[model samples]
Target: MSVLLNLREAHPALHTHPTPVLPPWPRVVVLPANRSPYGLDLPLDGTATVAVRPYVTAHEQRERRRELALATLGLDTPGPYWIHGLEVA
Candidate 1:
């Protein structure tokens, strides 16, 4: 079983708005299961999915925006990015 949490609703300050539009290849941040305060008693064997819309770096945002603009003008957009399965140990 997998547990999912919306960090934005849980800790708004940590996930402030104006969420950046990520590029085809974006950075990922992972938090360990033991670090969560709310899941102290939960089984460590299960997996947890931390859904977060992270803020991208300014440069990344600019690049993504530029791609969007080109797309709006009927130009070729960037290639797709895949989200492989998440692992919990």
Candidate 2:
């Protein structure tokens, strides 16, 4: 069985974005400044259906696995992701 990974709360500001139509669900993750877009680049889809809870919240930053965050925002949850950057590994 695919076990859901644990996630830690983080600052939303860290998720520097370029404006997106969020579906009030999926959590947004910001990639580092030095990384370019290529892998883990998911665009926001208007017709997404997923209840996104707070993967991480402000003042609650903690270490998390990369795969877990991906699953939460990837196909599993939705908001169109509304993300602009990738999470750390």
- C-alpha local distance difference test of each model: 0.59, 0.49
In angstroms, the error of model 1 at 48 is: 15
What TM-score would candidate 1 get against the native?
Answer: 0.27
lDDT of 1 at 36: 60
Report the error of model 2 at residue 3, Å.
99
Clashing pairs in 1: none
TM accuracy, model 2: 0.15
Q: lDDT per residue, candidate 2, 1-89, as tens digits?
A: 12322221334455567777767876788876764457545666757866545765422333234434766876344333223365332
Consecutive 10-residue window with the lowest summed lDDT within model 2? 1-10
**Model number with the top lDDT:** 1
Return the lDDT, model 2, position 74. Answer: 61
Model 2, which residues run further than 4 Å from truth? 1-68, 72-75, 85-89
